[model samples]
Target: MKRLIGAGLAVVLVPVLLLSMLVAVLFGSEDEAQAAPPGGQPGVVCTTAPASGSGGSAGSTTGQDVAGFSGDQLDNAAVIVGQGKALGVPERGWVVAVATAMQESTLRTLNYGDTMANGQMSSSRGLFQQLDAWGPLADRLDPAKSAAMFYTGGQAGQPGLLDIPGWEQLPVTVAAQRVQQSETPDAYAKWEQPANQVVGAVEGRTCTTTPAAGAAGGTSISLPSNPRAETVINRALSQLGVTYSWGGGDANGPTLGIHDGGVADAHGDYAKVGFDCSGLALYAYAGIGVAVPHQTQAIWAAFPHLTDRTTLQPGDLLLYSSNGAANGIHHVGIYLGDDRMVEAPQSGDVVKISSGIWGGNRGAEFIGAVRPGA
Candidate 1:
C-alpha cells in the first residue's frame, strides 16, 4: 500500500486494482517536433500554424508501465492530460480529470456506461463516462475529444471542470464531483496519487519561458575529439536541411511518417520523407555502427547519459523530455560542441543546428546528453 498526499492530508493507496467493469477502447498517438539550425541554412521554412485538429502521442513510455499503469492505460492517460494541456487546463485540472476517470472507468475508454435510476441504462460512455447529453456518440468515443469535452463541457446545461467555480481550490474528489456528479463522489480521492503520477509522467517537463543562458548560436560544428563521435556528427550534419517528418528516419535512413491526428497531420508529415528528433539521432549513430532504437527514451537508456551537461562532446545525443525524468523523454539531437545541436524539430521544420540544447523547441526540458558508442 502507498500513501497519497493531498491538501494537508494523506490517504492510503492500495497498490492492487480491483476491476468491477468491462474493457473498452483505448486511445493515443504521436511523433516529435523542433526549430532552426546554424548560420544561413534555409531553416524552418514555414512558421504559420496549421489548422487545429485532434492531437495525441502514444505517451512517452508506451511499452512499459508506471505505478501499475499499462501501455494502453498510460496511453489513455496521456490523451486525457494532453487534451487538457491543449485546452489550457492547468496541472490541477489534469489531476482532477485523471482521478475522476480512474473512479468512473479505471482509465479505460468504455463503450458502455452506468445505468441511472428508473431502470433506463444511462448513456454514459468514454473515459469519463460522459452521457448522451454531452454531445454526439463519436465525440464521446475519441479519447482526445472526450477529454476536451470533459474539460470544457458540452451541451447547453452541462458544465465541464473549469466551468465549476473555484475548481482550482477544491480537492480532487470535490472538483471531480462538480463535473461528474458521481453517486460515490468521494471515490475520486483515492486515485489522487496515481492520477498525479500519471499526469506527471505524461506531461513531463515543459518550459514555456526561456531557459537560462547557455551556448545558443552559430552553425559551425566543432568536431568531437573522438573518431566515433566525429563520424556520427558528420553523418548527422549531412542530413541538415532535411524536412522534419513525424516518426520519420531510422537506422537505415529517412522513411515515411505516421499520422499524429492533429497538427502534424495538417502539416502532412505522414506524407513527407525525413527524420524526426530521435530518428535523426539513431540514423546518425548508425554510421558508427551504434544501433539504438528509434524511440528517444530507448536511445537515452542505450548509452551512458551524461549527468553533467557541461561535459557534452560533439556527436553526443542531447535528450529532452516533457517531464525531466527519463520516462518522459520524447526527443533527441546530435550535440555539436559549443552548445550547438542538429535536430529535425517538428511539423513544417527542417533538420538544422539549434542555438542551444533547448533551442527551437518550446516546452521541451533539456534532460541530459546520451553518448552512443562511448
Candidate 2:
C-alpha cells in the first residue's frame, strides 16, 4: 500500500514540477520580454494616422500629401511601413514595401482573387496578392501578419529582401523581384516613384533619394597599384545606377539606346538610354587612355589572352562565351581584382558590381581573361 501510494505521488509531482519549469522558461522575466524585438507579439502594433482638415480627411497630418488613396488604402500602407520599421528595414526598404503593396493589391486587403471557371477564387489574396504558398489564409488576410511575411518571408522558404545579397544596391524593381518572382519582372519599376512619395507622406520626410552608389556590398576588390587600373575601376563605379541598354554606351560616353529588336525590345528597353556590357567595358578602358572595341569578341581579340585565371590582373577583360572559342565570346566585363567585376548586365538591367564573372545563366566556359595593352 505504501509503495503504490509513493509511485502515484511521484507521477503527479514530476509532471507538475516539469510544467512549472517549462512555464518559467517560456515566459522569462518581464524585462526579458520587453527587450525582445518587435513582431514578437501575435501581431504587429498598428496605429491609425491622424486625419487632416476640419472634415477629418484621410490625408497625412504630417503635412506631406498622399493623394489618390482612400482612408483604408492609406491605413494599409501605414501597416506595411510599420512592419518594415519593426523588422529593422532601412527607409529605402520602407519605400520598397509600400511600392510593392501598391503594385500588388493597390493597398487593399483582398480576400479573394479573380473568379475561376469553377466559380472559386484564385489562390492569391491579401495586400500583396500572396498565394497559398506564402502562408495560411488567415495569416495572409491579416495586414500586419502579411506585411511581416512580405518583409521576412514566411514559414515557407520563399525569398525575401533579407535573403537577397546586395538587395540595397539593386534597382527597386530588382530587389522586389528577388522576393516576389513575378512573371513580369520589370512591372515593379513603374511603382517606384509613387512608392517613394507614399513613404515620404507617411513618414513625414523626403524619400526621393536613390540608393547611394558603392553602398551595396563592401568593395570586394583591393585597389591595385596600377593608376590606369584605378581609373578603369573608378570610371565603371561612376556609372553604377545607369540603366542597361542593348547598344548604348561608347568610347565617348553613354549614348541614347537603340532597340535590339530582341528579348530586350520586349521589356521596352529601346529607350533606356544607358550602357550594354561591352559598351560599358569600352567606356571604362577609354577612361584609362586605352581604346577598346564595343564588341565582346573584338575586345577579346584586341588583347593578349591569359590562359589561367590566377594570372588575371585588374583592368583585364573577363570574357564569357557560349563555347570556349575565340569567336564564341559574347559578354565582356572589366575585372576589378578579387572576384568582383563591373558589367552592364542585360537590357532592363543596369551597370553593377557582380561578385563573380561566370555563374547562373552565364555558362561555365570562361573563354579566359584578356589583358588589354599587356
RMSDs, each prediction? 20.7, 21.7
TM-score for each of the candidates? 0.40, 0.47
Give residue 352's error in model 1 in angstroms: 0.3
The local lDDT score (0 to 100) that residue 236 gets in candidate 2 is 67
lDDT of 1 by residue, 95-197 (tens): 7788777766777777875544576666878788888888888998888998898899887468899898656644455567768766544456457666765
User: Local error of candidate 2 at 324, Å?
Assistant: 20
Question: Model 2, stretches more than 4 Å misplaced?
Answer: 1-67, 114-121, 212-374
TM-score of candidate 1 relative to the true fold: 0.40
Model 1 regions more than 4 Å off: 1-225, 358-364
Clashing pairs in 2: none
lDDT of 2 by residue, 136-157 (tens): 9999999989888888886678
